[model samples]
Target: MAEWGSAWSTTPSVGSRVVVTGAAGGLGRELTSVLAGLDVTVAGIDRPGTTGTSGVPLIEADLTDDAAARHAVEEAADLLGGIDALVGGAGIVDTIHRADTFPLAAFRADVEANLLAQFVVAQAAYPALKAAGTSSLVFLSSIAAQDGLPGQASYAAAKAGVLGLTRSLAAEWVSDGIRVNAVAPGLFATPKVLAMPASARDRLLASVPLKRVATLGEVVGSVLYLLSPAAGYTTGQILRLDGGAGLTLGGFYR
Candidate 1:
């Protein structure tokens, strides 16, 4: 423990080589900015036509496509001289839907975006991370995955897959000196979440122990911890950053 602390003291947050997928999205963009401020080298990948903040080497590609995702991962590894960390921030959410009425096509699309895309990126980044020898991977999950929230069946299922992915990968990759985990965050102030009707939002907020939405800084801090050596001994875990909504879950019905 002391040895890791000493190492962290010297390396700091700077000099880390990281790749962030879904880089143009709300959470991704915020994480990228924070990484930049830390002086870490970052390669960002997202769908075409989305612009990431300046200073990162942005690679635009449809990550739902396995081949394109692999290419982007390899390219990001090359650009970073190897990857010390990867943040699988790509996701899709279906709000206000009834499971019985949800179309199979829509359900499949959500799975592809929220679950399979993360798998694609994670698998593609494994070789690069293994080569790095002491790397970390963080997957994005949601509080929806934990409880049976109404109108969130498809999204919940996909995010639940992420939790399973996190645990499995953490076990499989530990021998390679790689750490894997996930953050099952509650409602954050992202565009999608903020767009919920006020009454609906209020209902959700009242259920939160924190009584407010999570800020970008809070989520980013959790990500930084998992990626840094400070959490070196942590793996196969889900950091439930949900403000205790998991403790009591009835108010957030959507």
Candidate 2:
């Protein structure tokens, strides 16, 4: 087995305070676990009623609420002594609904949950990130953003917004030594996807040229890379971890 702790110590030093939002979910929890094992102080923010994995300080707050997001950032900065990286991973995938008939309320909720929440969190962390110097901001987008997945209008729109945010912030903060970027994950076997019917799951898998869904580890590796000095020169880029699904044109004319 790989020595997780030793491996992390050999990686480039990038301060220590690493704050991850939505640390209760599968990907979020896994990322938190990995960071914690590296001996980095991690502070997580989830919904007010949600609970995160054990052994980490999880602050209860809703990212959609600007005040709550600010509070979470402040609390995390206080707990960790400073903020070195901000991982915007909290998101929601609502029930699919036809665009024409999709409730406007649901659409708004989706946008707020996915895109706006990231914005709020980033804004809240800006000062702390600047203070830390050489900090990184990682946003979680989705393949749906670039693929225009049917029945995912809201999700696509929100995730696309994240790409825009990533690029803009990368430019805006470069002089300040803060790097900003985003990760667009392809279909992964998370709890959410695994709960789908077998037929539905198989159909989705067939769309990927790789013929399989991505593992959470693959996706998280991209995030870690961006935050590490290995990607010191990389910024304003949207790294896609989608098993080649984004390149396929099979569903374009369907």
Candidate 3:
């Protein structure tokens, strides 16, 4: 085996073309801004009323709709000359509800936003990714999938589906030179998260082995690494950025 030296870069190639979904959201907007500053051309797809970020082309579309998602991705590809990477960040976590009483419609909505939408966007970007001869697709999952947070049945189920989808796509698209992976983030210090009541934040922090929440930069760093040449040989893997929180979960003895 080769020695662990700087054989490759952990950053996206300068001038690389990237597409981001859910660009209007906090994480998506942050990611788009970071990519734009990295010399990579970026285009974002979000809901129709989202305000466009400066320096990033934002295309409004209903990502859960197959036709609309495909059209938006194709338009982004056309504008960028082709696509080198795609970040499927569009998803929704509905208000917490008990599984027994969770509306079927709400469950479907979560599955549609978190699972089906990701698949559709990936399908739409396949041609461009294949044409690039080497590309990366990163999906956002959640630690809830593993820890099974209470009142998050639908969100957890949808995120678990994302894991399955990531692996399947990685296997099917390996020959096409497309790499697929996912990032499962735990409680991160986003605006909304940081604004939580002190007691709530403390409760969350107590569960994390690190005794703290992850920074948005750290989560973004994971995505960036997976999309760069350094992770070229890595695919179908889920990188859990939960600060060892997964270890705190109880395990079945049987």
Question: Could you estimate the TM-score for every candidate?
Answer: 0.93, 0.92, 0.94
Give lDDT tens digits, candidate 2, residues 1-254: 34445334433354478999999989999988888877578889998877787889999998888898889889999999989998999999974899999999999999999999999989889998999878889999987787777887999899999999999999999998899999998788698777899888787877677877788888888888887766777899999887777677763212
Question: All candidates' lDDT scores?
Answer: 0.86, 0.85, 0.88
Model 3 stretches with alpha carbons more than 4 Å out: 1-7, 251-254
What lDDT does candidate 3 reach at residue 206?
76
lDDT of 3 by residue, 1-254 (tens): 34344437777877789999988888888889888889689999998899756989999999888999999999999999999999999998755899899989888988999999999999999999999999999999987776676887899999999999999999999999999999999888778888999998887777677888888889888999998888989999999998777676551100
Candidate ranking (TM-score, best to worst): 3, 1, 2
What does the lDDT come to for candidate 3?
0.88
Q: lDDT value for candidate 1?
A: 0.86
Q: After superposition, how far is residue 147 of candidate 1 from its true place, in Å?
A: 0.9
Candidate 1: RMSD to truth: 2.2
TM-score of 3: 0.94
Tell me the deviation in Å of residue 37 in model 1.
Answer: 1.2
The local lDDT score (0 to 100) that residue 181 gets in candidate 1 is 92
